[model samples]
Target: MRVLVAGATGVIGRQLCPALVAAGHDVVGLARSAPGADAGLAGVRIVVGDALDRSSIQRAVDEAAPDAVVNMLTAIPPEIDPKRLAEQFTLTNRLRTEGTRNLIAAAGGVERMIAQGLAYAYDPHGDGPANEDAPLWRKPPKPFVPVLAALRELEQSTRDAGGLVLRLGHVYGPGTIYAPDGSLLRQVRAGKMPLVSGGAATFSFSHTVDIASAVVAALDSDEAGVLNVVDDEPARMSEWLPFLARLIGAPQPKTAPAFLARLAVGSWGVAFMSQLRGADNTRAKNALDWKPRYASWRAGFATELGGLAAADAS
Candidate 1:
């Protein structure tokens, strides 16, 4: 299959383009500039285009003439301000809605279309992990409502066009926020990121490698619905935070009161780190016949941190 990938130099796309090539698919990556076309995307062809611009996207799609199009476009800032973290995703939200529409529109005659979605948007209702059938938060916290609304629009557009939606969990790996030089790592090292109360909120995590593999699976399969592309283990902040800190040689994070946290990081940050529910990947595993290589963040973190350490030593 011939695949056109938008955001081809992004965290996920950087890894995905190569994976798709290795899996025997003809891949064309869309980049807006020379820097956006990273050297890592050596095997795949690169097309210059802006996903937000309909004309650029159309021209790129026409050039690629792909059988499928994967929308991996995002504009998340590397360093998130605690006070304005909720607003940081405003551009990414736009990418999901407008950028997605542009990609779909440009993907004329394409059979398969896959767009990204977040697993953390489900309402915190039950103790168990939420599945694809679970309801989204109808009334999310004020700051998060726009994010969820944009995600809903992205999913709706893709599904309406008979495309697949991969609702990925909190991604952590070499190029992600959990990496050695990433924002979360910096916060953990500074002791700024903390557990609110007992940190009971659950979070499902996926390694970027696994995320790429899942995309490959989705592209190969005919499954055309929302699939939660997460790992096997579902963990709470209380469990994951201290462990991560220890792994990275950081001081144990201090526990803050919910009110203090709300004042520091805002209500949305508090909810994200303390109240978000985990997602189940059963549907994705069964439907796409896929299983994550790093089944838990424990293994994923060790590999990522170890690699970072090795690189530093070299």
Candidate 2:
């Protein structure tokens, strides 16, 4: 299969493009700038294109002439301030909504399509693990409402285009926030990442590699719908934060009262740490015949947790 991957130089995209090549698919990587040497896109072809520009996307798609197109466009920042979480995704929101529409329009003839979505946006009214059917948070902190709207637009349009939406969990792996040198790690090390109201919010995590594999499986399959691409264990902030701190030898996470936390991290941050829901991967597993390699974040973190210690020793 000839596959064109937008955002092909990004975190998951860097890994996904290589995986597609390894799977014997002809892969074309779409990036606004020339892919740097570190992109490691040895066997793949790179096309320069701006995702939000419909004409540019059309030109790239025309040049690549792919049988399938994988839309991985996002502009999430290196470090997210929970206080201004929605603001951080301003460009990402555009990419998800506008960029997605561009890709679908450009991919007029290509039938096989898959786009990245988020598994962490479910409404907090219900139980722990939300499935594809669960409604998105009906109302959120005012700023976050647009973020949800963009995703809803992305999902609806992708499905309408007969594409599969892989709603991923909190992405973590070598190059992500969980990475040793990443800003989130630094925040934890500095004792700035506090637990909100005992940190009851559930979090579903997805490793970069695991998310890539799920995409590959989705590309191989013929069906189209929503699937929560997460690991087997849906964990809570209370459970994972301390474990991570210990793993990195960071100071124990401090607990913040609801009102105080809201003052510090804003209503969104407080709710994120206290009321956000996790997602279930059962449907992705059964539908795509896919399962995450790191079935639990515990095992995944254990292997990669030493970077801080190693950095300290160095």
Q: Highest lDDT, which number?
A: 2
Candidate 1 stretches with Cα past 4 Å from truth are 36-38, 307-314
lDDT of 2 at 239: 96
Model 2 off-target regions past 4 Å? 310-314
Error of 1 at 117 (Å): 0.5
lDDT of 2 by residue, 49-158 (tens): 89889999889889999999999999988888877877898999999999999989988979699999989889989966999999989898776888999999999999
TM-score of 1: 0.95
Q: How high is the CA lDDT of each candidate model? A: 0.87, 0.90
Task: Give TM-scores for every candidate, taking all chains together and pairing residue i with residue i.
Answer: 0.95, 0.97
Give the per-residue lDDT digits (tens) of candidate 1, residues 62-86. Answer: 9989999998889988877656856
Highest TM-score: which candidate? 2
Against the hidden true structure, what lDDT does model 1 obtain?
Answer: 0.87
Candidate 2 has a TM-score of: 0.97
